[model samples]
Target: MTHQESLYGKTPDQLAALCGELGMPRFAARQIARWLYVRHTEDPLRMTDIAAAHRQRLAEWFSPALSAPERVTESADGTKKYLFRTLEGHYVESAYIPDGERATLCVSSQAGCRMGCRFCATGRQGLQQSLTAAEILNQAVSLPERDKLTNLVFMGMGEPLDNTDEVLRALEIITAEWGFGWSPTRITLSTAGVVPELRRFLDATKVHLAVSLHNPFHEERMEIMPVERAWPIAEVAAILREYDFTHQRRVSFEYIVMSGLNDSPRHIRELTRLLNGIKCRINLIRFHRIPDSPYFSPGDEAMVRFRDALTARGIQTTIRASRGEDIQAACGLLSTRLKGGI
Candidate 1:
């Protein structure tokens, strides 16, 4: 018996090719897409339009994939953390946040992260293989509450910009008419400002962009994010300057506030200076402490003061409402935990 084709990885174009190879009609691709994405129909035989013989043949060759939540923990505030076991036997975590009317699922791009951010839990593990487009999208597509999804972010575990090819291909599959068909506006990809990968992403997609700039000063930033030692935030900002984010797309900075460490009026001034000429919002996130991290969460008062300081300097800044804290599933907390940590 032949091995099955990975149904999760097939793009519409790939699906069309699959249908052609199976000796099926061209229109069969449309039916298959409708069944897969629109109707959420997983059973091949349920596709009554396809001939019975072809249905069996297709079913034998393809199977809809799902990373069933091997472990699910729900927080008091309705945030859910799911540990999904990939087919490769790696466990990656994804979070589903239910905000009053809309639900957002934060997906992972790689099995583990390579970028060594002092604050992130995922960074403890060295680089694992990049997730395939299927693995990346399945975080949303295979979720039990997938139909209720209103937004998706490549912000769960891995640094999305590092896996540029897989990330972009997955976005294409997500927004394609034959796939999830979501507007690019519904998705956001975050990075620790990897300059070259970031340039390619900005040119190729209209999805919202978020740069992880925890500290504005180069010296202090380098202490936390090692990438800063190579591609400085100044260079990242220069590349961003070339893009027009005025109306079509959004651009934002993710500044995780560490108490007395990187949260102060002085830090705010430096942040404002760094973003001097740009029209972008700064989201001040509360620091989530990891083991041996030595960072403390910034108090609300300090966060508010910092936000106002940046705003007074003509920079749009907002202190982000911290979520998923009760579940140990907030910012900088996601990791595959595949081998129970290093």
Candidate 2:
């Protein structure tokens, strides 16, 4: 059975090409874009502006192909974890977090992660497959609160930079004028510093960036995140220094503080030395304990003290509030729970 291509993630240009190939009027492309994005309508028949004779053919050749979430777990803090099944039958999770006036959707870029970060559950499952741009965009387009979503963070499941081509394609559709037209500032891509791809991303888009720099020292970071050995945090910082993040686009270092591990003043000193002269903020994240994990989250007082130490050094820092801990929806907790079985 050959699967029909999904039109939900296609940009206006691609749709225009499809129209040209199908012998349909070029104007039909914009109509389809309006139906898919502005009107949020997926059914070709419901695209009333399109010619009646072409609607059936359009539906036959392409499908909206938005897969509904297989399961939804809501947390007490108004955070919802949505498990979506990829076309390949593997599962990935996206978290929708609502904080007062702000609502952010954390999206996944792949089925399982290949980065192999020790603290990450997704990394534990290993790499299954990469999601197409359609699969990635479907998570947002099919959301119940899609209209209310204020921000999108590529911080779930996999290293987005590893899937650079599809991730960039999705970003283009998300922010293009004929697509969703959302501001690039509202989207942030987080990566464990795949240097070349990170450089490519920085050159291509102005979306905010968050680099996983859990430890300042190379050897210490390599202990948990193996990516450190390939592209050292120092080199990542150097690459970032070449760009100008002092404007609207922002860059931040994600430091997941582990108890008695990287919460000392020495780490702060090294961090200050490493990130010196870079116009960026540091986000201190509390480590969520996984099963049989060797690390533990630091106490609130300890976190506050670390934040104060960095702030006193003229660096802007914030202790990110941990959410959905009960449902395992926080950082590094998203996984399929299936191993070799499927």
Candidate 3:
């Protein structure tokens, strides 16, 4: 049996090529795009604009490639975590966080992560599989509050730059005119500094970037995040210096504050020195404790002191509010382990 492809993630150009192969009119591609993206309908039969025979032909070889979440857990704060099962029989998660006037959905790029950050739950599961553009977009498209979403972040389960191609494809579909047509400013892709793909991502899109910079010293960062050994934080900072983030496109570093581990004055001084030239903000995240993890969140005063110290050094900084902790949907807490297949 031949495998069927889903039309959900294909770009207008890609769909046009498919139309040529199928001998359908070129205009049908845009119609299909409107159906899948604007109308949020994946069923070809409901695409009345397309001829009945052409719709039948599409159905024969293609599936909508959309699936509703298998399970959803809501937090006391109203944040919801959606569990999605991939076509590959693996599970991934997406978090929907609604602030006063802004709603952000944290979507996953891969089922599990291979970066092996000691403090992250997703890293402990090891790499299961990289999600396709379809699977990645499904998190936002199939969302219950899809229309209300104000921003999207690739910060859920995996390192986005680790799966650059599919992530970029999803980014393209997200911001393209024939697709979701969202402003690049409304999207942010977080990475653990996969250097090569970082360069590619910078060149390809105008979306905001968030780098995981939990530690300042190279040796110390290596102790917690093994990616430091491959792509040092120093080198990542240097690469970032080559780009321009002073305008609409912005870059920010994600720092998870641990009690006695990384929130010391020495770390703060080094962080100031490391980020000297780059015009970026530092987001201080409270570390969410995982089972048997030695790391712990610092006191509120300590976190504020760390943020103020960084702010005093000229880099703008703020403490990121922790959300969905009870549901394990906060930063560094997302994992599919209890949902079964590792």
**lDDT tens digits by residue: candidate 2, 35-100:** 887777878888888898888778787755788898899998889999998877888899999988
- Model 3: residues with Cα > 4 Å off, grouped in runs: none
* Least accurate 10 contiguous residues by lDDT in model 3: 1-10
- From the highest lDDT down, the ranking of the candidates is 3, 2, 1
**Lowest-lDDT window of 10 residues in candidate 2?**
1-10
What count of clashes does model 3 give? Answer: 0
lDDT of 1 by residue, 121-172 (tens): 9888767678888778777777888889999988888888888888888988
Better of 1 and 3 by lDDT: 3
Cα error, candidate 2, residue 253 (Å):
0.6
> lDDT of each structure?
0.83, 0.90, 0.93
Clashing pairs counted in every model: 0, 0, 0
Structural similarity to truth (TM-score) of each candidate = 0.92, 0.95, 0.97
Q: Indicate the TM-score of model 3.
A: 0.97
lDDT of 3 at 310: 86
lDDT agreement of model 2 with the native: 0.90
